[model samples]
Target: MGYSRLNVVIRADASVHIGMGHRVRSEVLAEAFSEQGAEVCFVVHASCADFSKEGDFVFGSESEWHELAHQADILVLDHYGYDAAAINALFQLNPNLLVLDDNNNRGDFNCRWLLNPLSLRYSETVQFPLTGGQCAQLRPQFSKYRAVNPIGQQKLLLTFGGTDPLELTLPFIKSLFVKGFPTEFLLIMVGSGVQNAKEIQDYCRQHHMECQIGVNQVSELMAQSRFAISAAGGTLFELACMGVPTHFIQVADNQKDALAEHSALGWCSATDFTGCLPKQRVSLIDKVVESVLKTWQTDLTQRSQLARECVDGLGAWRVVETVLASRLVK
Candidate 1:
């Protein structure tokens, strides 16, 4: 409730099902708005509230979407759980609708602003009856990020998003330990989709990689880490903007093209997961550790610079302004 005049509402959700990237990005934009003197309220499904990214006033009820929208100058939706009717419900009450759509599924939303950042590889995900310009690639608001300070090469960040369903995170940590990678401070981010917290705990003890699971302060961890081993989803952009060198894993087919395209451009490295079994995936962790340390030892300056240039930030800020501008025009 930092703003005295405007109330901005962000409706997004994170689950073991939809994954954490959705909420992570939503939080990024909402926190930015909060710092700019906006009272940001988040409307989410009750079951998904506990896993939601921090900050903002929270409303955990599906029936509350329109009600919350009525109180805001802008409504930002970043979840796939809702379809056209759910989204239109909010739009019916407010002229401004900002949707963070992946897959370009809702390419036709009747809204003021629509974000299809980096475009969507899974066309069916957003090729819906919704009407709005498909414009997710309109640049991000990384410059407007509310996080302070930066990671001066202390720890390594590992985030595989929502499920970590493959149980890949802790296995990788053990590989790092076996390979004797520096364990001064390792921050591991996972989602409820992963039921292996206990296993992660035991492995961390065995190798003592200062790693933890299910961290809520993921941005803070990214800001603190020297580099990252991440799934090629939303976090890729965040890591690039943070200037953290990254090695990517495609956890799903939905993410294949983005990962491959970015890797080919040297924005990051891609480890193919197609038809790769779980045990085989574990072995790849060894390759990741080896590759990471080797890259650091050989040429780091070029890597960091590349990452910084790929995502210069400001995406969320641009999105917010776009929505607001559309509202003003009407």
Candidate 2:
């Protein structure tokens, strides 16, 4: 926890418009940076936002172009809404800025380091019209904070979002119950920010589907599981890296492409939640859960390959090491 002082500022252009991957990955990156003794801060757009963090200097409202950049050795931008002008708005004040993007549109960025660690399939998404110094193309690195090598029962996690605001869990889990599948526990990680946690809990109890909401002990719970059924986003990467084989379901449109791609490669099975499922939602969940269970049991070989290729569990460390080793101040 002790090292050289590092003021790392991250820009995440997230809102109700964008889903939660950017902020989530940014937070994970910040946690990695913190492990190396960096003081991390995040600059978010001025909107009705609920995301929060400790030791995080939250900047917003007027979108203060604070001299925090001058203090920070690294200014990493993970936003999607911001184009060159938006990046320029911040970077003009601090010339030594590094941008981390996946969409591959860093057009004429004064970027010292341009990172796109996505796989070859995703390369097209990020292959910009222009070019710059490619950033650290990382091997998969699992999170140090998360559970490693399973020590307990299979932790089945169902995290749609920090806030599954739709109250979709009851119908979703009820569908699983109707299937009468053999499974130990189903952990439903929820954010209190979402108002439907209570409704989800009562429904879980009624159906005898073991469920727990609230964001406590998730990483540990996930580690204990032999397999996971989760949304295809940053969590998919984390689960694969942790060696927790997953039955991935895309809960959003953006996730569908990634899920399909990752599933095609045997990383995770794709059961999407983005379409109209008639009026019979429970029936659909049952069908999906059954499919997930079947694939999870018999598809170990593919899953193992997926675990290897997606993330070897060292990506966090590698990125941090790159950040530290690439320090210009030294």
Candidate 3:
């Protein structure tokens, strides 16, 4: 059967602590589901910003999900806070469940499908049947772009995802300036919900750098940049898509494993910001600056090729097809 008014409820959350990757990815899924004639709604926390126009957002307690669970033809989860028990409850309410996870750090989850591109074949290592059975590898939608030619681009982009809760922007700029990070290449910093925006803007102005707040055309920016210093989160996929060689720094726990794997695979260079308090990051500026300059000097031909090859923009379509096929099977 076709997706005629099929109800898809996406459960996720966004905040300074949780960051925005989950919500952003969920919005992408919502778009794909909506195109297939599904009614998509978001069940998020009250603190979450209203970022998507494609769906309605609802706020309530965990018990409230039962109501949504009852109405949903399928429930998609992206939030890390949801445990197995909670997911099991939702699964009992509605058997059609799909989980989008990165680390697989959580315990057992009784869901019909689990989408994790990183560990698709490493399911045995993570103790989950995430490879051969009901699991599907879902990459970001940016993998569809052609390799970016870096000849004319004279900018170094900096993005730390949505919140930058660790406040790495200003320190990174100062480190670059201290290391004299090529004044010929302009610096372009972008972010949202940044508490230190004024300080960052002032620093950029004083240093002749360009700062863009709340930018919507991030893909365009990434494609145009010659280099980037970014967080090792979902944005890494976008950077990889454009073949923009990046130096990644982790600001969340979920990103640690992926950072290690990606860096080991030569996709990007990484640094961990976990455990180290925000105040202590200032001392690590030299290390960050050294890594960025080193990576910039190295030839990126092979690294760019590997990065672009990892993701294809067709993941959303794949997910939609798989979900629909599973429904038909039922």
Candidate 4:
């Protein structure tokens, strides 16, 4: 059952437009595959090349994908840009194709296995298993940090993915200030993709607040925060693993359903800002501030407990096992 001979190639991309959630989660799964003795490589777009490791391939053409598909024993794809045609082309090269999906809105996939951590619906076309937050691929630091009590200072950790494509960081902070929220209670973590990092840093400095850009030790920051306001993406699962009561904002169309599901489960508070104008967003911020305060006052402890119970921080291993099991059966 050793995976030493297996060659797993993960294909994903990150940029200011799409954010880095895809690449981040793919790395978590890649780490699990590597730990199981499998050789792993990432094939990413050029825009994301700067964030990739030394041996990672920066793909530019279809021929490059064909070459990777031919070489890979199992091709793990976690990109949203690829349609069915692109996937089918890869499946033709290697039958052992595993796709990491969130919304399952790509019509149909030609892969051997399809995994959606947000849902557990049966699929007739491909094998779908371990479909829940229990399969969320978070880094090892989250689980290690989870062992520590997360009820630290009353500070709020704020992040909006790697890009914050919507530019929610400064606006959110300004709204908090406008609402008379304690300036000392904010710990802003700006993403590398954010174009206004300099401005955010300056604003935080002027207000005597803390701000960090492109931090690798996010778990440490989460451990220091009793609550959080984050975008509804992979970070939600990570915060859940850390047991930080969070209020998540929907910044994308695909996040709508997941937000509703998590909210219904009492894991976190949810808000939708997908199509709001600048003025409307400012108004919505008032509602978000109210919700954050209400949740902090009413059910912070319960939400934290529910979130921790939802994701145990071992999902990457479970996914690796599933892939290994498939190889064994084959």
Candidate 5:
């Protein structure tokens, strides 16, 4: 079952507003497809064209999407901007449509398959054979860097997605300092879309703390960190794969349900800070930092074990095998 003849076209986008989770996960699947000898191409929005590779396509209109779909053997869509009508139109162009979704909130999808790695719940109407965190698409680096003993250094990794649209990094770091958390142990990762990177870098320098902007080797950092304070997005699953105990925060409306679900599963702890007033936000941050310090003092063996048990770092391979095995691939 060589995939040398198959062509996989992935449609996703990233920007300062929407973040890079979609593009990152799409790349994970793309790598898996490439490993199987499939020809992979990315179709991103014009705003994110700068991030595209040599053979990638930048599409600005729905008609442009249809044009790409007409040529693809399998069109993998991971964008939130597409509506049910738009998805159905792509299905008309090519029936082998695989939609990567977070939630099944959209009325209905006429695609051949749907993959949602965050939630386990599946609608009776839709064909959601692939669900749950086991399907979480993570890069191969995470598996390679997975901590064997699940015990890490004293450093605490902090990431707020690729954009940090709410601008939570500096305020959160400041809150940690004000809450008596040691500044020397903080390892801040500033995303490419973070508008206040200069300010954050200056603050880190003044405090003599470490900060990295648009880092490529994130798995190396995660492998060395004892714990993390991350946004409730794809990074949570990545941390889980690395067996890092994390306290996650919801930064967007779409992340709310997934955060709650992951918390209930004991994969990670939650810190509710969204939609708070300025004064209340400060209070919540102080409380969360205090709680984090307390949790750090205790043994995190159970937390790490639970996280690793849920995400085994083979999700991308699982998804690739499923897609290649499907009847639609022909």
Candidate 6:
């Protein structure tokens, strides 16, 4: 079977509200598919007319989607907006459909394969395949980042998703200052499309903290970090693979499941700020930061081991291989 003849279409979105995890994940998958000689096209959704045009924008109606679905060899859905019924419609058009999801609540899946990298543990109650499907237990992208940096050169990393809609970056920096931000560990903050980018940069400059915007080298930074403060999302898996200890906050409601379960599994130090008020958040931030600072290394060895064991960083390859093999059999 020639993979070069295969065509894969990935449908996902990136916006302030939905976050950029889906878009980034789709890109990763696209690169993997392309590496295997598959023709991949990413059809990102535009939320509304008011939504700013970014990336490769494709406009089409439902009929157009059906048309494309008919021509595509495989259709990959990684959006929360797509329910099982909606997915079923696309499945009928193309039986070779892949659904990438974090939440196991998407009811029944009618796709050829289901990949849920978010949920590391395999259980009987899980919605997707436990052993047969591509779960991406160990992400392949983190291979370069797996090597731990010298402890003395490590910094404290800060990242709040791609958009940082909650504007948690600056406030978290201020909280650190309130607790007398340690000069020993350099602060590194990263974000794209953040509303408060200028303010954060100014604050960072004034306070001598490093602020990076629209960066593509996060895995590199994660490798050089002693610890990271990040939103509980896809980055969790990356951090785990890099063996970087993190303090996580569930900035979005959809992140609750992954964050809670990963934290329970001792992946990172975490707290839920879904509905936290200003005063309460300030207090909680201070407490969480201080607690992490004190015992950050208590389980560092074990956490890093679990992370390396769970996230091998070859998820993309596994996905490409599985999907292609399934195609040949059909």
Error of 5 at 70 (Å): 1.7
The global Cα lDDT (0 to 1) of model 1 is 0.65
For every model shown, what is its TM-score relative to the native structure? 0.73, 0.77, 0.88, 0.94, 0.93, 0.88
Q: Which lDDT tens digits does candidate 5 get at residues 1-330?
A: 678988889998888778889999999999999999999999877888866677888878667767768888889999988888888878778888889988767777687778888765555434436888789999988888885444555678888988888788898899887777787889999888788999999999998889999998888888878889988889988888887889998777778777877788775788766687767777777777888888889887788778888788888999889878878733
lDDT of 5 at 187: 94
**TM value for model 2:** 0.77
lDDT of 1 by residue, 126-185 (tens): 222232122222123444342445535667787777677677787777777777777776
Cα-based RMSD of the predictions, in order? Answer: 5.5, 4.9, 3.4, 1.9, 2.0, 3.3
- Which has the greatest TM-score? 4
Model 4, 180-249: lDDT tens digits are 7787888998887788899999999999889999899888898888899999889989898888888898
* Residue pairs with clashing backbones, model 4: none
What local lDDT score does residue 293 receive in model 3, on the 0 to 100 scale? 81
C-alpha local distance difference test of each model:
0.65, 0.60, 0.71, 0.83, 0.83, 0.71
* Candidate 1 vs 3: which has more TM-score: 3
* Colliding pairs, model 3: none
How good is model 5 by TM-score?
0.93
Give the TM-score comparing model 1 with the true structure, all chains together. 0.73
> Can you write out model 2's per-residue Cα lDDT over 120-211, one digit (the tens) per residue?
22233222212211222222233553335555646566666555544456565665566655435666666555567787778777766666
